[model samples]
Target: MQRPAYLHASYRYGFWWLALVALGLLALGLGLRDPWPADEPRFALNSLEMLKTGHFWLPHRGGELYPDKPPIFMWATAASIAITGSVRLGFLLPSLIAALGTLALVTDLTNRLYGRRIALLSGIALLSTVQFALQAKTAQIDMLVTLWITLGAYGLMRHALLGPARGWWYLGCAAMGLGIITKGVGFLPLLMLPAWALLAWRGKATPLRLKELGLGLALILGVAALWVVPMALITTFGDEPGMAAYRDNILFKQTGKRLATAWHHVKPWHYYIVSVLPWAWLPLVLGLPWVVPSWWHRLRRLDARVLLPLSGTLLVVVFFSLSPGKRGVYMLPTSPLLVLAMAPLLPGLLCKRGLHWLATGLLALLGAIFLVAGVLGAAGLPALTELAAKYDVTPWVWWMLLGVAAAGLLVWLRPRRGMLGLAAWLAVFWALWSTFGYQQLDQTRSPRDMMQRVVQITGPSAWLAQPDFDEEFLLQAQQPSVHFGFHTDQDAQFLRAFDWLTQAPGERWMLIPQRKEDQIACADLSQVNDLGLQNNEHWWLIPGTAFASCQGDASAAPLFVAPTTVADAATAGYQPATQQDQDGVTATPEDSGK
Candidate 1:
């Protein structure tokens, strides 16, 4: 069958329209809310502290060296915050830019490998995936790392499959190096080499040259040294107590040991295969039945385009699966390559009636679920009512879900355009979730309001210490705060906090989460003031008097790192706690218990 001229022209221009739509979808609610928990606030706090302390090389969180991850993502975030002068506005910029960059790279690579039509479809497919959109809107390292990995793959594929272009290969190596600095998994794109070698063996691709390979390896090393050499030099010679540990931790435990002898987030090896991909990949995964067969057929024909990306993605999945530790976001870097491999088959597969119905049915099913949940929630059903009370969400959230349900079902009801309707429904879901949903859930998900209440209860002059605190609390704290350490043992943190509180009984206070109240051996939980629920945890504000009966741990000295700059307090609309007030205040033992 021949395609018409108008359809051809539409295919040529479709990606631009998709790009604009993606920009709006990914960037709709930029500055409307504070960073939420789990990872966002941690990264945002790292970026803010970087700007405050002017420590660009080694990132810190709550005034302690953060050694879990490299600082490239934080560096980008700090640069964004520096330029915008607002964490709310700048924190998510890196992910947004990286997401857009990934889309552009995928589109261009697919265009070169396939054609304009496949390229457009690939972009649309990548944009439509749940994980891609979610990561794009998040202030996390995964999205930025994915961009670098995609760029690496793009460069490698271009030179290996399309040409003997040395520049592109070197560019790819450099990108992989940058990815390594951004996240430990950035070297993932190099997995494509085995597939490239297979292509070369099949006489379908150029053989690797030793000199070029050595130079490319050198490029990767050189780019990584940009951060590595300086960090090593400073930490090795620096008088800072923890610098050596930070050096060793970031270089070893956080990388190889963390991977091989994984301590956290452990799941069975089939976790991704069984649990994550089916949902995380979304509309793309829905087509895998057809995609898999087509891919096999292409592989049989020794098509380098299909073989390279497919093998790279499989190798990445296998690479992570071998590790005891697994997170779904660890698979993010594989998405662009997966989509590229799927691009050539997508046009025909998308047109299949079964796939269309499946996509539309999924959309309809989601709409029904939302509609039912909203209706039940509005009717004060016990499950929904308990959920609302637990999360402190309002009735309007239910109403908003109803709206999303209505919008999605309406699109699904459209005739013979199931794929288009599915796309529309996804667009509505993300747009609403980012803007309306963000505003509605911000109070509960974020610690901003909770911190405000703390400040109100304790007064502006009070010096606060959070023991075993989440980053969101510290980021949103309106008072100048001290923390024992982020990774310190909970009981040890409380012991240190108790000692610190006794130093200035009248002026000092401790904030503790209910989950960790067991660690407060010295404090009377009854005397602790409840600060209601925030971020799914009950926080207590304990006046120094609450710990007055504590046995002294005078020898237990904790690292008392105060914010280098309390400008964030000003930004939060409170005066920074004065050092004089914190240090000069002294109360007699009798007055302390008052």
Candidate 2:
């Protein structure tokens, strides 16, 4: 078979070019987009809070203890922010480094295990995997945890391949310890046990002295102790409620409690098998059937290198699957192992006539589907409209159709490297989507613009308060005008806010939930604007209160008409039809106090 154009590019210009392209694509939109709600903003806020408080040992959010995760990610993000001073750039670097570093590690490992061709292929495959790419760009702890797990796994593999004299065991354990502090399941690298056992059963064991193994265990504990011991000592001795919650949640609820009975993300045993691996592993999933059988044939020989990846992959999958609390990102550590398992088979598979046909056909089908949907969606077909509406499908999505069309054309024109071409095409598609399309979507979902509108209406001299506001609003706004009050069961919270609004000597603006409008209505505060956030949540803003005159005319229509952003049309979440302000209030010209 003739070498494919992409492979030829790799052979001639060197595959580092491909790696650079992949990393560059991953880094494309890092500085442009605002922090997304739910996870992104929360993580970013925690890091920012850490930076503000100068309390590096414990992570807090909005003046409260945050124990859902350890402080490693926050520490890293805070350090990045301290140095770079750009929230987007700072919060993004850790994940980017982890992702590119993982790719480099995979390349190095594969090159050692197989050869240059397979190493390049493995790096490309792992980099372009849908979940891996998405997680790398996200400001979450998953990618950081993945990095530590990958390092730990590589260290163990080195020991297995070379010998105990190398101390790869200790290095691997230390990485796993770092992973644990980064995320709770850092010890997942220990899944190598089953892999080592498989090899031993096949008489391929690399015997290690008991002392060395003990030392590795100690290293893991020692790394964990650097944080755990300090946190425990301080929180145990201190009477601070937040610190206590942090200790309890981090040590138990986030780990043991989650394992025993997770409150969120509860899924059935087959969740990973059904929902995660199939999609998360994507192009690799398509190749697994061929790869698995080939590995199975070699199982009896139990080459340490082959057994290491196969067993580690199976163990991680099964372990996460058994947990009732499962998320796709939890299994990120398996990406490299899957890449390793598939590398030996890739050369032959790349040259296979049948695989080439499969690649071309799949790409063509996907392209045709995208083309039809894009045309229909553009043509205002109700079915597609409803579907597009359900996903906040942006006008920019037409670009994806172009991408799909290009991918299809490339594969058809160069069938010899259809798989590689398709992977490269998808990577470019994702990069472009994240770079441009993401901002378009974010403009609607994120409250950054909405808050800016609030600041505009209220002006800099005015004082603004959001009682029990989400961190996204605060972080994105970044204005001293904003004041936060803790949400609680007490009615005094509302009374205090109303009293403040009614008695404040100057203009006092507040963002309140629409549902609570009745509670503060007696204050006679006039509604200025509103914002619709994710999950059917809506907030209303009252301009200022000094006059006892109550704009109690509750029937006023919305003064500000929210343009139908693409998100409003696409999201399944309820979009209020009234000419509502972004804060979810209907304002009339009469009520605008003009």
- Evaluated with lDDT, which candidate comes out highest? 1
lDDT of candidate model 1 versus the reference: 0.80
- lDDT (10s digit) by residue, model 2, range 140-251: 8999998888889888887776555346778889989999899978898788876675565556866655677788889999999999999999998988665776688789
Model 1: colliding residue pairs = none
- lDDT string for model 1 (1-594, tens) is 333222345675688797898898998887667778899888887877877678888998888889999999998987876665556667889999999999999998888888888888899889988899999999999999999899988888888889887789999899989988888777887888887888988888877788888988889889988998999999999987689999999989999999999999999999999988887888888888888988888889999988988999899999999999999988888788889889889778756767767877777777777776777787789988898899887654545574576465556455345666677778778888877787678788877667777888888789898877778878777777998878777667767777878888889888887777567766777878888887888778989888887864644546656563324623532222221223544333122210
Worst 10 residues of 2 by lDDT: 557-566
RMSD (Å) per prediction: 6.5, 8.8
Give per-residue lDDT, candidate 2, residue 61. Answer: 61
Off by over 4 Å in 2: 1-15, 382-393, 396-404, 407-416, 461-463, 481-508, 513-528, 532-537, 543-594
Could you tally the backbone clashes for each prediction?
0, 14
- Rate residue 574 of model 1 by lDDT: 23
Top TM-score hit? 1
